[model samples]
Target: DTAVSQTPKYLVTQMGNDKSIKCEQNLGHDTMYWYKQDSKKFLKIMFSYNNKELIINETVPNRFSPKSPDKAHLNLHINSLELGDSAVYFCASSQVGLNTEAFFGQGTRLTVV
Candidate 1:
Protein backbone atom coordinates (compact mmCIF):
# COMPACT_ATOMS: atom_id res chain seq x y z
CA ASP A 1 0.00 0.00 0.00
CA THR A 2 1.12 3.54 -0.69
CA ALA A 3 2.31 5.35 2.39
CA VAL A 4 1.22 8.68 1.02
CA SER A 5 -1.00 9.54 -1.93
CA GLN A 6 -2.21 12.63 -3.75
CA THR A 7 -4.82 13.14 -6.44
CA PRO A 8 -4.36 14.75 -9.86
CA LYS A 9 -0.67 14.18 -10.38
CA TYR A 10 -0.84 17.01 -12.90
CA LEU A 11 -3.00 20.11 -12.87
CA VAL A 12 -3.32 22.68 -15.62
CA THR A 13 -5.40 25.78 -15.05
CA GLN A 14 -5.63 29.40 -15.97
CA MET A 15 -5.02 32.40 -13.77
CA GLY A 16 -7.85 33.45 -11.47
CA ASN A 17 -9.18 29.91 -11.40
CA ASP A 18 -9.65 27.94 -8.20
CA LYS A 19 -8.35 24.45 -7.55
CA SER A 20 -7.75 21.96 -4.79
CA ILE A 21 -5.40 19.05 -4.17
CA LYS A 22 -6.25 16.18 -1.88
CA CYS A 23 -3.70 14.16 0.10
CA GLU A 24 -3.90 11.17 2.39
CA GLN A 25 -1.37 9.13 4.31
CA ASN A 26 -1.84 5.65 5.66
CA LEU A 27 1.29 5.64 7.79
CA GLY A 28 -0.63 6.82 10.83
CA HIS A 29 1.74 9.69 11.37
CA ASP A 30 1.04 12.42 13.87
CA THR A 31 2.37 15.27 11.74
CA MET A 32 1.62 16.28 8.17
CA TYR A 33 2.90 19.09 6.00
CA TRP A 34 2.46 20.94 2.75
CA TYR A 35 5.49 22.02 0.79
CA LYS A 36 6.15 23.90 -2.39
CA GLN A 37 9.02 23.45 -4.80
CA ASP A 38 9.61 26.35 -7.09
CA SER A 39 11.06 26.40 -10.61
CA LYS A 40 14.52 26.78 -9.13
CA LYS A 41 13.93 23.61 -7.14
CA PHE A 42 13.86 25.37 -3.78
CA LEU A 43 11.65 23.47 -1.40
CA LYS A 44 9.86 25.35 1.36
CA ILE A 45 7.32 24.35 3.93
CA MET A 46 3.99 26.06 3.53
CA PHE A 47 2.07 24.53 6.40
CA SER A 48 2.39 21.92 9.09
CA TYR A 49 -0.13 20.18 11.31
CA ASN A 50 0.30 17.86 14.26
CA ASN A 51 -2.59 15.70 15.21
CA LYS A 52 -4.97 18.00 13.36
CA GLU A 53 -3.61 21.06 15.13
CA LEU A 54 -1.90 23.85 13.21
CA ILE A 55 1.74 23.98 14.17
CA ILE A 56 3.82 25.78 11.60
CA ASN A 57 2.56 28.16 8.97
CA GLU A 58 5.01 29.88 6.67
CA THR A 59 4.69 33.22 4.98
CA VAL A 60 2.31 32.10 2.29
CA PRO A 61 -0.38 34.14 0.60
CA ASN A 62 -3.94 34.20 1.87
CA ARG A 63 -5.05 32.53 -1.34
CA PHE A 64 -3.46 29.34 -0.09
CA SER A 65 -5.35 27.36 2.52
CA PRO A 66 -4.63 24.01 4.13
CA LYS A 67 -7.21 21.87 5.87
CA SER A 68 -6.69 18.69 7.80
CA PRO A 69 -9.82 16.69 8.34
CA ASP A 70 -7.99 14.15 10.47
CA LYS A 71 -4.53 12.90 11.27
CA ALA A 72 -4.29 10.96 8.02
CA HIS A 73 -5.48 13.59 5.53
CA LEU A 74 -4.52 17.09 4.60
CA ASN A 75 -5.92 19.04 1.68
CA LEU A 76 -4.85 22.26 0.00
CA HIS A 77 -7.19 24.72 -1.62
CA ILE A 78 -6.05 27.60 -3.75
CA ASN A 79 -8.32 30.46 -4.69
CA SER A 80 -7.76 32.94 -7.48
CA LEU A 81 -4.72 31.11 -8.61
CA GLU A 82 -1.91 33.18 -10.01
CA LEU A 83 1.09 32.53 -12.23
CA GLY A 84 3.26 32.52 -9.14
CA ASP A 85 1.29 29.58 -7.82
CA SER A 86 2.64 27.30 -10.51
CA ALA A 87 4.91 24.89 -8.73
CA VAL A 88 5.20 21.36 -7.40
CA TYR A 89 3.10 20.84 -4.30
CA PHE A 90 4.15 18.06 -2.00
CA CYS A 91 2.32 16.30 0.82
CA ALA A 92 4.35 14.69 3.55
CA SER A 93 3.82 12.92 6.88
CA SER A 94 6.00 12.06 9.84
CA GLN A 95 5.80 10.73 13.36
CA VAL A 96 7.00 14.01 14.88
CA GLY A 97 10.03 13.08 16.87
CA LEU A 98 13.78 12.94 16.77
CA ASN A 99 15.10 10.89 13.84
CA THR A 100 11.62 10.40 12.44
CA GLU A 101 11.51 10.07 8.67
CA ALA A 102 8.97 11.86 6.55
CA PHE A 103 7.22 10.15 3.68
CA PHE A 104 6.27 12.30 0.71
CA GLY A 105 3.81 11.89 -2.10
CA GLN A 106 4.77 12.03 -5.77
CA GLY A 107 3.63 15.63 -5.81
CA THR A 108 1.03 17.58 -7.76
CA ARG A 109 2.40 19.77 -10.50
CA LEU A 110 0.29 22.88 -10.85
CA THR A 111 0.60 24.97 -13.99
CA VAL A 112 -1.17 28.26 -14.49
CA VAL A 113 -1.46 30.00 -17.80
Candidate 2:
Protein backbone atom coordinates (compact mmCIF):
# COMPACT_ATOMS: atom_id res chain seq x y z
CA ASP A 1 0.00 0.00 0.00
CA THR A 2 1.21 3.47 -0.76
CA ALA A 3 2.06 5.53 2.27
CA VAL A 4 1.04 8.78 0.67
CA SER A 5 -0.83 9.20 -2.58
CA GLN A 6 -1.80 12.18 -4.72
CA THR A 7 -4.22 12.26 -7.61
CA PRO A 8 -3.68 13.58 -11.14
CA LYS A 9 0.07 13.01 -11.09
CA TYR A 10 0.17 15.52 -13.89
CA LEU A 11 -1.98 18.61 -14.36
CA VAL A 12 -2.00 20.94 -17.32
CA THR A 13 -4.10 24.09 -17.16
CA GLN A 14 -4.22 27.62 -18.46
CA MET A 15 -3.70 30.83 -16.58
CA GLY A 16 -6.59 32.18 -14.51
CA ASN A 17 -8.03 28.68 -14.27
CA ASP A 18 -8.65 27.03 -10.93
CA LYS A 19 -7.66 23.51 -9.99
CA SER A 20 -7.40 21.20 -7.06
CA ILE A 21 -5.10 18.29 -6.03
CA LYS A 22 -6.20 15.59 -3.68
CA CYS A 23 -3.89 13.75 -1.27
CA GLU A 24 -4.30 10.93 1.17
CA GLN A 25 -1.99 9.17 3.61
CA ASN A 26 -2.50 5.69 4.94
CA LEU A 27 0.47 5.67 7.32
CA GLY A 28 -1.60 6.76 10.26
CA HIS A 29 0.51 9.81 10.66
CA ASP A 30 -0.54 12.71 12.83
CA THR A 31 0.88 15.44 10.62
CA MET A 32 0.52 16.11 6.93
CA TYR A 33 1.96 18.81 4.68
CA TRP A 34 1.90 20.39 1.25
CA TYR A 35 5.13 21.37 -0.43
CA LYS A 36 6.06 23.02 -3.68
CA GLN A 37 9.19 22.47 -5.73
CA ASP A 38 9.96 25.25 -8.14
CA SER A 39 11.82 25.09 -11.43
CA LYS A 40 15.04 25.58 -9.54
CA LYS A 41 14.18 22.55 -7.43
CA PHE A 42 13.84 24.65 -4.31
CA LEU A 43 11.43 22.86 -2.04
CA LYS A 44 9.34 24.87 0.38
CA ILE A 45 6.58 24.01 2.72
CA MET A 46 3.27 25.62 1.88
CA PHE A 47 1.10 24.29 4.64
CA SER A 48 1.16 21.83 7.52
CA TYR A 49 -1.59 20.25 9.55
CA ASN A 50 -1.48 18.14 12.66
CA ASN A 51 -4.43 16.00 13.49
CA LYS A 52 -6.63 18.13 11.26
CA GLU A 53 -5.47 21.35 12.94
CA LEU A 54 -3.60 24.01 11.06
CA ILE A 55 -0.05 24.20 12.32
CA ILE A 56 2.40 25.82 9.97
CA ASN A 57 1.43 28.07 7.10
CA GLU A 58 4.19 29.58 5.00
CA THR A 59 4.19 32.89 3.18
CA VAL A 60 2.35 31.55 0.18
CA PRO A 61 -0.12 33.52 -1.90
CA ASN A 62 -3.73 33.68 -0.80
CA ARG A 63 -4.63 31.90 -4.02
CA PHE A 64 -3.16 28.73 -2.60
CA SER A 65 -5.32 27.11 0.01
CA PRO A 66 -4.87 23.83 1.90
CA LYS A 67 -7.64 21.88 3.52
CA SER A 68 -7.36 18.85 5.77
CA PRO A 69 -10.64 17.16 6.46
CA ASP A 70 -8.88 14.61 8.60
CA LYS A 71 -5.41 13.60 9.72
CA ALA A 72 -5.01 11.18 6.85
CA HIS A 73 -6.12 13.58 4.13
CA LEU A 74 -5.00 16.99 2.91
CA ASN A 75 -5.99 18.72 -0.28
CA LEU A 76 -4.69 21.76 -2.12
CA HIS A 77 -6.73 24.25 -4.11
CA ILE A 78 -5.30 26.89 -6.38
CA ASN A 79 -7.33 29.81 -7.68
CA SER A 80 -6.55 31.92 -10.74
CA LEU A 81 -3.49 29.94 -11.60
CA GLU A 82 -0.52 31.75 -13.02
CA LEU A 83 2.37 30.64 -15.17
CA GLY A 84 4.73 31.08 -12.25
CA ASP A 85 2.60 28.57 -10.37
CA SER A 86 3.92 25.76 -12.49
CA ALA A 87 5.84 23.36 -10.32
CA VAL A 88 5.81 19.98 -8.62
CA TYR A 89 3.49 19.74 -5.65
CA PHE A 90 4.29 17.10 -3.07
CA CYS A 91 2.14 15.67 -0.34
CA ALA A 92 3.88 14.38 2.78
CA SER A 93 3.00 12.84 6.11
CA SER A 94 4.83 12.18 9.34
CA GLN A 95 4.35 11.31 12.95
CA VAL A 96 5.64 14.76 13.98
CA GLY A 97 7.05 14.60 17.49
CA LEU A 98 7.82 10.92 17.41
CA ASN A 99 9.51 10.92 14.03
CA THR A 100 9.87 13.92 11.83
CA GLU A 101 10.77 11.69 8.89
CA ALA A 102 8.21 12.41 6.25
CA PHE A 103 6.96 10.16 3.49
CA PHE A 104 6.26 12.03 0.27
CA GLY A 105 4.08 11.21 -2.67
CA GLN A 106 5.31 10.97 -6.26
CA GLY A 107 4.15 14.59 -6.64
CA THR A 108 1.70 16.29 -8.97
CA ARG A 109 3.28 18.31 -11.70
CA LEU A 110 1.19 21.39 -12.43
CA THR A 111 1.82 23.21 -15.64
CA VAL A 112 0.21 26.54 -16.41
CA VAL A 113 0.14 27.77 -19.93
Candidate 1 vs. true structure, TM-score: 0.98
lDDT of 1 at 7: 89
TM-score of each: 0.98, 0.97
Residue 62 error, candidate 2, Å = 0.8
Taken over the whole model, the C-alpha lDDT of each candidate is: 0.96, 0.95
* lDDT measured at residue 60 in model 2 versus the true structure, 0 to 100: 90
lDDT of 1: 0.96
Q: Flag regions of model 2 displaced more than 4 Å.
A: none
lDDT of 2 at 48: 91
> Lowest summed-lDDT stretch of 10 residues in model 1?
53-62
Q: How do the residues 1-113 of candidate 2 rate in per-residue lDDT, one tens digit apiece?
A: 99899998999999999999999999999999999999999999999999999899898999998999889999999999999999999999999774479999999999999
Look at candidate 1 and tell me the lDDT of residue 29: 96
> Following a full C-alpha superposition, what root-mean-square deviation does model 1 have from the true structure?
0.5
Model 1 residue 106 distance off true place after TM-score fit, in angstroms? 0.2
- Residue 56 of model 1: what lDDT? 94
